[model samples]
Target: MKVELYDTTLRDGAQSEYISFTVKDKLRIAKKLDELGIHYIEGGFPGSNPKDAEFFSRVKEIEFDNSKIVAFGSTRHAKVKAEDDMNLRSLVDSGTDYVTIFGKSWDMHVRDALKILPEENLSMITDSIEYLREHGIKVFFDAEHFFDGYINNKEYAMKTLRAAEEAKASCLILCDTNGGALPFNILEVLNEVKGKIKTALGIHAHNDSDAGVANSVIAVRAGATQVHGTINGYGERCGNANLCSVIPNIKLKLHINCISDNQLKKLTEVSKLVAELANMSHLHNMPYVGRSAFAHKGGVHIDAVLKNPLTYEHIKPELVGNERRFLISDLSGKSNILAKAKELGLKLGKGSPEVKVILDQLKEMEKQGYQFEGAEASFELLLMRTLGLVKKFFVLDGFRIIVDTHYEELTSEGTIKVRVGNRYEHTAAEGNGPVNALDNALRKALEKFYPSLRDVYLTDYKVRVLDTTEGTGAKVRVLIESTDGKDSWSTVGVSENIIEASLKALIDSIEYKLHRTRGQ
Candidate 1:
């Protein structure tokens, strides 16, 4: 069966904490989702907020090749006619051919939330769908709290769906509003609802209990024609079912084609792109697209995967545009180094003496609280040194940094002295912090010798305390990520002094850039 994929990232997903989409963000994300072959993009509830209304008005200007835009709103108020309800009027005015509206499914909600009788709630749903259809809009009815409502009042829940069906709703979506329904219950209720209602069924699940994806898949197995979710499982409270997981599961595991196989390969890129736009850190352990999803760390697992990926992997990572990774740590073996070296374009044959030396060095460094897995630049430098390929770009003579606290504000100044071949340069600079000051001073010193250094800048800096037990004397590891417009690299350093650690990482960042630019 060909299942439809409806994305509510711009609507329900924005309800997630710390996630807000601007008009341009919504338009860009909609185009991205459309490129990923989403069937429908729920722009937002047009009448709920001015931003969403503006989004709908502006989204009409862009041409989406794949996905259809959906305007979301609630059912007409019990006290007003559907045609007179401003919410319904806004949905029509949004100029989207598809409209989705949620209505009260639980009898408790009808009485307490809407303050209306059960029949009147049913009338509200039917009237809203009828009104939208009369305006030549295809309506998808969201039976909010359908599972909970079914458990509380099966007859009323079924009647609500029947009302939507009688009003000729294009699709009937069962929403797990509380996100507490188990997969079994969802399957059972959906099976029953399938027999009761004639409209096409869809699943909209939340992740309060962490069963959102499971419930969504189970519903599809039972009988659902569409699945509604967010790109990264972003939503209120917990989250929505992650479409990143759901779409692949439907396509590969269930043998149902939700999106083309080529589009499936763009899953990882799309997932990260969405996270970047939302200004949220990507969850490394998220299924299918996460950084750690296909990573192998244990010696046994890494060996098995190296021999035959099927030995340790359930699915090929490349299928989802994610690559298998051999993580180097205390648990790493010779094979791991060989694979990593090969990946880095180094010609280190299996069982080479260089590999054993690098392995020994790595183990000793890891014992001293150095992590190479996250510091690829540091590892590469280590490999180059072991192979006798390292060339010093400059020699640091000395440096001094001063921190001043006056007028209730803290400022720092750094002075650096360096030698480039026979020429020496000394410079001083001030910055917001000691690291920034050091960076500024060092770059000023080297800019004359290596003008391309101006094109290189530190993009991110992270510090981790290796041993908190040491308290104030704990060894800190600094990881500096630098980008030279075209590429990015990460270098690591560890020392009891934070300044020394940051300087080591900074020096490595510069050397790596110089080495890539000039073979020497």
Candidate 2:
């Protein structure tokens, strides 16, 4: 049987406390998910919130190629009948062809959370599904906490699925809600459930124990026709099962096709785009699309991959919209240096003296906490310096900005001091904020040294509080990424004072650009 992958990134993924998508973002994501060739896209909970409901009403106008938008909701409230339940009614009016409804399956949950008898819970499940089917909507029944429900009371869990089955649930999704079940135990239950249910079966897993991917794969091996997951595993608590990991695993490892070759090429781009829209940093070690997924640094590995990429990499990075990178770091060997040199159109043979010199400087600089992993342009500069390509750029004659705040007067004072070439200049600027004043003053100082610096603008600045203490002291890391329309580079600074870190990175960005300009 062909396996179907259902993506709940927008619906379940929004359960993540940090993620919230605008209506347009949801529509854009829905179209991207369809582009990935997912069988179903769970958009959001239609009746639960205004944002989700607005998204669902607007998503009807979107054009999709191969995916059906699935609206998610609970089965029904305890006192309300499925036909009269406002939640179920909202799902019907949302204009989606398919709907997913979750019902309590664990005995503890049904008894304590709902305070209802087991038979009434079964009736709720049957009625909710039947009502959707009666309205010509495809229904996928999610037996919430199904794995734990099966473990505690196998008969009741099996009976609960029977209720959904009799009511014509298009598919029965068994959820590892708490994500505590091991693979072996999951396989055992999957096998048992398969023997009992004649309808299609699916698996929805969470990553609480860090085994979401493992359990999902094992469930598929035992016979799950569908797998549910979110992009990059973004969801409530630990996370949902990572479709990024599972898709490649199912296609490459099991030798089965989960999605078309064309759809797979857009995987990495979509992954990063979702992270950008959500304003969350992408995990660099994520299985298929991470920055370091195919990065090589060690000498032995680099040599082997150069000969045959399959010797080190499982899949070609291009297959998933990613690329191989040769990282330069302390652990780098001769092969690593040569590869990096080759990228810059320079030739360096193994055991070359030039390579030795470059490697030595890299190690010494790194010892002082200079990081090049995210600063490729800076690393290239280091290589040029080692090759004696240093040309005279304007000297950084010292510069400083001072800010003063007085609560009694409710006024702040700012001043900037600097030396340009052979002359010293002082500038004063006032702004609503101290940082704004400092930026203005620094730019004033630099314009005298290089007129072109005026055309270069600070396009983006980011500040992150790195470490926090109990109510008082904290360390901040500031990353200032700037662009000159054609090129962009990032610089970093870390200090206890937020202002100091921002200043350090800001200065580095300006200095690095001047250095590059001098070469040109």
Candidate 3:
């Protein structure tokens, strides 16, 4: 059977410690989820905050192609009737056809948190569903702490589900609310109550026990037709089961068609987009959509992948909009060098002397604290220089920087002279700091000959102290990442003097930018 995908990103994802999506963010994310072919999106509770209320109001302008919006709320209070409860009334006001209502299934919560009898909690469940059904809303019932309740009191838990099923809930979602249940526990409980109720079952898992994805996939194996989760697993208390992982496991591993082939190819792009909107860095090692997911580094593994990717990869990365990557490192062999050389448009054989020379230089530089794993531009430049294929755009004559401070304010100036094709150019510029001044002065001297440098700008600059024991005079490694609008590259430099290290990386970046202007 084709399983249903229910995403609670806007609702549960906002509960993550560092995640706070604005109304605009919710709309954009909801739109992305729709385009990616999700079936349901749980928008936040409108009654809880003005932001969510505004989101529901603004989202009406958007016409989704694939997803239906869902509003979330709890069961009616024990003392208040369903029609009189404000939270239930708000669910209807949210202007959604589908709604999810969570009710206490564990007797412990009923006796302690709700301070009510078990029968009263069941009535709350029935009343909430019945009220929403009467209002033309499709209700999805979340049995909060269902697994825990089943373990402590199987008969009571089963009774709660039967109440919702009889009350006409569209789907019964079993929630691992505390997020401590294991796969074995889920399977054990599910086996005991497989056909006790006629309602269709859904699984809502959490990651505190690190089995959310596993439990979700297993629930499908046990005959569930729907899975509830959030994108990137963002939620409270270790987050929910990651739909990024769960969807692929269902469609690719379990031989189920939960999502379309075209939708599967957009997974990586959507994952990165969501991370960007969340103001969080895309996790490098996240399954299916991470930068390091298909990266091969070891010598044997690199050779094997070049020959047959199936030896190291579970599936072709293109299936999920990701690509295979070969990492350059000390552990790399001739295969790695040859692969990188080919990627840079150079042809080299396994026994080529240039390969050994480049490998030796790479290892020596790594030992000197110059890392090329993230600095591929520097590695490419090294290959060109070693092969006598490098072009000298300009020859640096000399440069100097001066800094002075008055009160809390500071001023820095850099002067540089260069010979571009034997023509001399000298320039001076002031900046907020030494590095900035140097960059400004260098471009001032060279932009006349290489105007493409005008488009090149530093996007990221990082410095790592390689020898902390030396303290003030410790050697530092500087990595500078530059972009020319169309492409970006990283270069590295190592020196005890921070300014010198920065200058070295800056020069390499400029050279790379000039090379990019060429069709080569």
Candidate 4:
């Protein structure tokens, strides 16, 4: 069976909170979706904003391989002609052959939101679709709030579908605009639509009820030929359906072909790619395309998985371009340690004493509020140091921070002295804050010794209070992220003083960078 995949990452996804896709971001995602073999890519509402309008004009230059770029907008206004409707006119000017326009399907929406007669709403749907069709544009009619509309007034909702069908819409897309429909609700409505309508059907689902993927699959099972979704479920409110999960469920589980096997493997890659471009961290727990999706931390689970992957894994991690990961933590057992060591290219006997030492050290560190989950670089450094295989690079002699405030303007200065082998370098630098000042001073003292250290810079810094009951005297944990452009790593430090904790993490970050740059 074949199900068409339509991506709205550039359109509906931009409506997500804290997400504002620039023209370049939209263009980049559209190209990725096209390469992944999506049947349709909803670029954006053509005239919604200057940025979106410019996106439509700029998108025309890039040629798509397997996807059609689509313009999205709403139906004509209650009193306006489709020819003169600004939204409808923007659709024609968008320069795309396929266009998606939504119409109010719920009677409450017609009465409240549109403030028009239910009959007038139907005319708007017919007129907008027909006008686009007259210009040789294939229209995808989105029936907004459709599932709610069907339950409240089946007669009026069916009338709206009939309106679009009568207007020769290329596809009738039923949208769960509020995203509260369960599978049974969707199945019931789809069965009714199949019995009454002849036009091709598609489903646009949202994740408010957290069944976006399930409802989309149910719609496909009920013979809806098309599925609409965003890349990582990014959208207004909760989110739109996640194609990252929807596509895999439809292809691998349902045994349907929405995209080729090669394109399917791009799921994880594209998921993270879109997340990075959106300036959001990729969800580590998201199904199919997440970092932790196939990760095993339990010792028993790891042992069973190594014996037979089917024991703990539902599917091969490689199936979706994600690899299995064995996390090393206090809960890890001998099997976990061995497997993790093997992954890290550390040769160890089955019963090596070093393994127990590493495990014990890990547990002790955790007790002291050290979390290695997001600090893989720190974990590896600690592991090597525990194994007595690490080389000392530099030793910190002492460091001091001084702050002066005058007229409400504060200046922080950091002074540091470090011994590199037989030599010592002392440096001082002023900064906006104590952490920044220390970072500058340290780099100033080390750049001449290792110029590559100049390329290493802090990317993220996070602090957590471990013992909040102690209030001002609480121990704090600081996690610092550093990158040399091509690669990034995270390190953690814990102390009662925030500056001391930050300094510890900063020191680990530099050591990790030097260890990495030396190709060790």
Candidate 5:
């Protein structure tokens, strides 16, 4: 079966906390979505904000081959004509051939929100859809709060959909705006509506009940032709249905055609790109595209997957542009080490002395609170050292940090000394914190020897207490993620002193970059 994918990332997704996209960001994202084979891209509500209005005006310059640009808005006001409604007028002026207008379906919303009679609400829906159709725009009517409306007053909800159908709406999208409806409820309501409405059916689901994807799938099974959602499930509150999960489920599990298999391979990249652009940390546990989605840690699961990946993985990770990871942990076995070695292009046979040695070292380091799962760079460095393939780029001589408080103002300063090749360098710098000061001083000293170090910078730093029972002096583990704009890597360190831990991780980060660059 053919199903249409409608993405509202620019519209509903912008309502998420801390998700503010510039006009350039929106246009870039829309193009990316189009490249991924989405059928429709809801640019934004053009009348709601100046940025969205400007986005609609600027989006016309780019050519989208597969996806159609859609302007989103609400129906005409009950008190005014459709032509006079500013929101409705903006949709027409957006210059898009497609428009989505949501209308109240529940009688309670009509009386309380719109402050109009139920009949007037029906008239508004019909008039707005017909007016947009008259302007040579294909109309998709979103029945907002549809599940709740159907439960409260089935007759009025049916009437609202009938009004849209009578106005020649291309699709009637049933929206679960509150996102509290269950899959069974969605199936039941959509089945009843499918029998009543002659127009094409669509679904717009939210994740408030954590069943948005399930509900959307059920609606599709119940004959919804178009599925509306956002990439990475980004939206207000819990979020909208996650297209990353929904699209694959509909195509692979349901045996339906959504996008080509080649397009599916770009899923992970697209998901991460959206999260990066949104300035949010990607969820490691997210279903298909997460970093840890196919990670194997336990010995039993690792051995089984090594023998045959189908024993543990539901689908091949490569199908979604992700790779299976054999995480090095205390629970890992020799098979885990072999798999990781194979991935790093190391030749470690079964029952090799090096395998046991590496396993023992990993267990000891993990006991010391080194988490190799999140610090793959550290793990790779450790593997290279064990295989005698690593060379030290520099040696740390010593470091000192000093904090001074004068009158209520506080300042942190760091000094470092290091030997690069046959020469020695010393540097000092101040920063907002002890770690930052150390980072600045160390980078300042290293840049003299390695010019490429100027392009490298720390992107993220996290510290975790290994043993709280040891009180304030407990061992702390530091993980630092660094990037050189083109690529990124993670390194880890552990020590009783927080500053020492940070310094170790920082040193590893710089050494990793140098090693990769120099082909060491």
Candidate 6:
């Protein structure tokens, strides 16, 4: 049987700390999930809140090409009939064809958390499933904490599943609620329950002990037919099993085509997009879709890769919407430099004198905490400047900035003795901040010579305390990312003064833009 993949990114993912998706974010993420071709999407608990109810109501308008939106909730309360449970009524009213409900599978959870007898808990599970089925909604019963529950009370856990079977649940999902169960435990429990139940089983894992993916793999091998996860592993605590990791592992490694080939091609894009929507920086070391997933830094590795790509790379980066990067770092050797030079349309023979000079500059800058791996524009500008290809567009004049408690002021700012092709222009401008003032002043000074600078604008400014309580009283590192309506680039600067760092990065951004424009 074909194993199915169900995504719960928007619902369970919101359970992740510091993550709250706006309606716009939810819609965008839902569209991407649809594009990913997941078999099911557990949106949210409709009866739990107004936002989820609104999401389900609006989600009906979104036509998914490959996935079905599922409504997730819990079973009826103790002493309450399933037909009369408020939670069950909400599920039916959500208008979703599929409804997933979790019950007390563990004896401890039943006796302690729910404070009810195991028999009563089993009845609640059975009655809830049958009620949903009676209302024409397919029921997916989550045996929460299944592995641990099975280990503690095997007979009770299996009996609870039997209850689900009697009620005719469409699928019984085995959940690692605490997210601490290891694969061996999963395989053991799955081994016992694989053929014992008449219903198709599913695996819903979390990543507390970092075994979510491993447990998922083990369960699938043991005959589970469905995998539950969130994109980029977004969920409570350490997060859920990353569908980005699970899909490729199952599809490419296990020869199980869990998602369509077309969806597979857009996997990396969708993964990054979801990360963007979540406002979380994509983990560079994350397996297939990360920025550093296919990066090569060592010299020997680059040489071998250039000789034969398979020498260093296990699979083509393009297979997952990722690209290989030749990083320039201390470990980078001659092969790396030559490859980078070749990419920049520059010729560098093995052990060239110019290569030594450039390497010396790079090493010295790195010692000062410059990271060229993420600042390719700065690196390229440094290379060109060292090669005597850079032209000085203008010179900076004296400028003064003053700041007080409530108000700040910048004055006596204008270019003087500035040479631009045997002509000079003096100008001044005020802005919101000193760095902005400096930027405005510099642009005003150079606008006549480089009129294209008029179109440039700063979009992002990031500051880092490099040593975090060390290095010149927390040496400030600044990265300013800019765009000229057509292209974007980033530049970095580090200094003891935060303003100075910001100024330097701003200058680099402008100069880099100017150089590229001039060259073009």
Of the candidates shown, which would achieve the greatest lDDT relative to the real structure? Answer: 5
lDDT of each: 0.92, 0.83, 0.90, 0.91, 0.93, 0.85
lDDT of 2 at 427: 72
The Cα RMSD of model 6 versus the native structure comes to 3.0
Write one digit per residue (lDDT tens) for candidate 6, span 451-513: 788888887877888787686688877888888899988898988888777767877787898
Per-residue lDDT for 134-212 in model 5, tens only?
A: 9999999999999999999999999999999999999999999999999999999998999989999999999999999
Candidate closer to the true structure by TM-score (higher is better), 2 or 6: 6
Please give the lDDT score for candidate 3. Answer: 0.90
lDDT of 1 at 372: 80
Model 5 TM-score is: 0.97
lDDT of 2 by residue, 1-520 (tens): 5889999999889888899888888898889888988889999998989899999888878788889999999998887988899999999989888999999889889899999999999999999999998999999999999999999999999989999999999999999999888899889999988988999999999999999999989989999989999999999999999998888888878767989888888889889988988889889999889989999878789989888999999999998889998988788777888888888788778867888898888888666455566766567767777787655443444445545557754343346677655777777666546656666677777777766567666666676654455223576666767777788887766677777777767666766778778722
How high is the lDDT of residue 174 in model 1? 97
- Which candidate, 1 or 3, has the higher TM-score? 1
TM-score of every candidate relative to the true structure: 0.97, 0.86, 0.95, 0.96, 0.97, 0.91
lDDT, residue 355, model 4: 83
As for lDDT, the candidate ahead, 5 or 6, is 5
| Candidate 3 lDDT, 1-520, residue by residue in tens | 8699999989998899899998999999999999888999998998799999998899889999999999999999889999999999999999899999999889999999999999999999999999999999999999999999999998899999999999999999999998999998888777766778777889999999999999999888887888999888899989999998998889899989888999999889888888888888789899988999999889899999999999999999998889998889888789999988888889899888999999999899888888888898988899888998878888889999999887878999999999987699999999879998998899888998887788878888899999999998999999999888888899988999999999999999888777666512
Candidate 1, which segments miss by more than 4 Å at Cα? 406-408
What are the per-model C-alpha RMSD values against the true structure? 1.4, 4.2, 1.9, 1.7, 1.6, 3.0
Q: Residue-wise lDDT of candidate 1 within 353-413, one digit each (tens)? A: 8988988999999898889888888888888989988887899999999999979899999
* Regions of candidate 5 where Cα sits further than 4 Å from its true position: 406-408
Model 4 residue-pair collision total: 0
Estimate, for each residue in 207-244, the C-alpha lDDT of model 4 and write its tens digit.
Answer: 99999999999999999998999999999999999999
Q: Which of the predicted structures, 2 or 5, would earn the higher TM-score when compared with the native?
A: 5
